[model samples]
Structures are given as C-alpha cells and as structure tokens.
Target: MDQHAQRHGARAARSHGTVEPEHGATTAARHPELAPGTSGMKGRARHIPATVSLPIITALAFGCFIIFRTHTAGIKGGPAMLYGLAGAVVSGALGLVVAHFQSTLITETRASAYGALFGCSLGWVYSLGGEAILKSCAFGFTMGAVMFVAALYVFRTHRTREPHGLHRPHKTHHRDDRSHRLPAATH
Candidate 1:
C-alpha cells in the first residue's frame, strides 16, 4: 500500500477496536477480562509498574540487609534467613498495598503514608534482630522522612505528566440569539 493509504488505514484501525501491529496487543488482551476504562478512579494506578516492581525490589533488599547485618553481628545461617524472609514478606506486602492504592489517596498524603509504612516495617524488622527500641525508632523515622521527601517529588512529577480529575471547565458554543428573536415591539 502507498504511504498515505497505509497511514490512513492505521489511523482508521486505531479508531476502531483492532490495534495496529506496531502498537502491540491491547491491554485487555494481556490482562484478560479487564476492559479499558472500567477501573474507575484508580484506573491509571494499574499502569504504574512500580506497583509490582517496588515490592519485589524491597523484598530482595531486605533479604540482602539481613544477610549482611547478621554476618557482621556474628549470627548464624538459619536465623539470618528467618529474619531476612520475615522482613522481605512484610516490606513487600506493604509496598504492594501502597503501590496499588496510591492513586486513590491525595498525592502528598500517599507519599507520607507509604514512607511511614516502609519505615515501620524496616524498624520492626530491625527490632526483631535485637536492636534497641530507641535506636530502631530513630532509624525508622529518619528513613521514613527521607522516603516521604523522595516520594513526594516523584509523585508530583508523575501527577503533572498525566492530567486527571473532573475539574476541567467545559467549552460552550455561543450562538447569536438575535437571529431567532421576534421583531422589537413598536408602540
């Protein structure tokens, strides 16, 4: 087909349900049973890859931390694995929850909440490893605060890139009413 015709055909196909080959399969095809535009207010949340990745990353990081910390503290193998696994599961679960429901909360609040959750999970894990309560709390709070600041920046940038909400003003067509009016009354 000629370039113009091919371009037109692609556009026409996109306007309908069928996706162009270069564009890849539709999201519904990949996810199955998830129709587009059906996710409601949190529709965009599913698109954010961090929802899945952050949890996995956090879990792995926790496992690593446990390994290093235990080794340095002279703790043995099985107990180190136990601590690591516990921290991984807890942090991962919290990360998943934050990533999934993040879109529903106010941007700043979501960041702070997620940070706090992350910090608390870490703090709890640290305490389980025999750290002092005061030290754990202080470390957790510091980590949480750092996360909060970082997340706030990231989320703000993300929000700006993708516009949302029902606050946009509608455009109305102004038509001249004089043409439809009756003749002015003459006494």
Candidate 2:
C-alpha cells in the first residue's frame, strides 16, 4: 500500500479503539492541580513591588502637577513643595487602597471607583490653583461622570464572552451512516 493509505489506515485504526491522549493530556495528568480549567499558580501572591508600581507612578505624576500648579499660583517654594509632597503621599495611599480592592469589585463599581479617584485628584489639583471649594467639587463631579461613562463604553466594547487564550474546540466523532452514502443510479 502507498504511504498515504498506510497512514490513513493507521489513523482509522487508532481512532477506532486505541486510547491515545488528546492535546495537553500528558501535562494535565502530571499536574492534577492544573487540571483543565484551573490556573497552576493558585495560592500564590503577586510580587509586592510590581503590584504597587502603577500606584506609585500615578502618585508621583499627580504630585508633580500639583507642585507646578502651586508654583504658578505664586505660592512660595517651601509651601509649594510641601503641598506637592503631601498630595503625593495622600494620592499614593488612596491609589494603593483602590488597587487592593479593585479586583474584588464588579465591573461597574470598579469603573466608578476609578472615576471617583480621577475626579478627586483633578479637583484637588484645581483647588491647589486657588479655585473655590464648591467650584472644584462641581468640576470634579462632571469629570468623574465623564470618566465613568467612558469606562463603561470601553469595557462593554472590549469584553470577551470567554476567557482569553483558553478556547478549545470540541472533538466530534464521524459515523458511516447510510444518510452519508450516495444513492445508486437507475439504468
């Protein structure tokens, strides 16, 4: 028999009764903890520095903006620096708290939390430029609403129905049924 026919026959034979494993079966068998749907890294915590990095960076940027705004408003060097440093520390703490709880929140609440954070930060910066408290709050509320709506839109548009990178096509068996056969021609 030709090599192709030999290979096809072998495949058919294997499919008929052989107990060959599907893809990733061996690896999954070796690690029961990583069984089909589970992530292998259960009970492991993420690195602390990596987790805090984004919040720190955001705090630093917020502080720098506050410092610049304070200075432009004719605040003296020491007070401007103090204001900036204080704002940085507060923002950093707030950011860390938000980051910690963000994962546990539902999508809408998480988005609103982020929006509130952003709005508060912006309003604080605005106030540092000598704006009145009422005006600053109104501005912050408006900005927060905008952020919340934008976040909802983005999340809705970009969300996937299934987990990323975890799709597996189902295996289907073919049968040699009479419905699949061609009809005989009449003489």
Candidate 3:
C-alpha cells in the first residue's frame, strides 16, 4: 500500500479504539515477568523512601522559618540554632505520622488531620514571638477551622460531576420553525 493510504488506515483504526500490534514483539518478549501462567506480584508496593522523604522536607522548611524569625527577635545565635533544630525534629516526627496513615482515612478525616497539622504548627511558631499561650492556642484553633472548611469545600466540589437536575435542559429544534429553513431555491 502507498504511504498515504497506510497513514489514513492507521488513523481510522485509532479513532475506532483498536490499533494493530507490532509484528515482531510477542507479549512475553515485552514483559518477561508476566510469562505464560505465572501470577506476578499481588497488591501495590508501598514506596517507603519516597513517603518518608516528604516529612523530612516539611521539617526542613518549618525549621528554617523558625530560625529566621527567632534570630530577628534578638535571640542569641546559639539559642536560635538550638530552637530551629528542635522545631525541625518535632515537626518532622509529626509529619511522618500524618503521612503514614493519611491514605487509609476517609476524605473528611484526612482534611481534618491536615487542618490540625497546619494549625498546631503555626501556633507553635507564633508562640516564639512572645505571645501568651492562650492567645497562641486561640489563633491556631481559628486557623485550623478555616483550613478544615476550605479543604472540605474543595474535596466535595472536585470529586463528583454535576447532577442532571442541576444542568439546564438542552434546547430542541422544531421542524415547523420556518425561520430555520433555507430560502426557497431562487429561479
């Protein structure tokens, strides 16, 4: 067949959802692990290292912010360093705990977990500014509630398609509408 005809045929096949497989490669040749009757591995493998690294990254960012803020508040260099390191460790541990179990949770629970995490972290950092404990806690609680509400809204909106009842009914064309007809053929 000519190249143009072959290209047209291939395009038509793709539009119909079936593609001719490559001639020289057998299934076994492409993936040896799935040979004949063998069952490969079951279930999805957890990516342990990747999962663990997220919390470490979060901790580093949190610690850097704390260190910078403390130094700006006139803390001595050694004390500022200590505070940053300690904050990093604590945040990292909390992040690790959250990461481990987040996937198994329902949507609402997961949102609440993230909201609490953010609120508590921010509140701790706020306390470093010499705010009273009660003030810090209150600030954290307010921020957390806001986060929870926002997260809930996002999750609910994105997960589902709009209901049929919510959609405007499509307009139908009427054969009797003379305006839509072509002008009578001119002589």
Query: Candidate 3: which stretches are off by over 4 Å?
Result: 1-50, 158-187
TM-score for each candidate, following the candidate numbering: 0.58, 0.57, 0.55
Off by over 4 Å in 1: 1-49, 125-130, 161-187
lDDT score, residue 67, model 3?
94
**TM-score, cand. 3 vs. native:** 0.55
lDDT of 2 by residue, 1-187 (tens): 3487566553323454443344223554665555677665641323346448799988999888888999999997999999999999998998899777765666688679878988988888888788899999999898988888997676556556322322334655466666756798989
Better of 1 and 3 by lDDT: 3
In candidate 3, position 142 carries an lDDT of 85
lDDT of 2 at 168: 39
Minimal lDDT window, size 10, model 2: 160-169
lDDT of each: 0.73, 0.75, 0.75
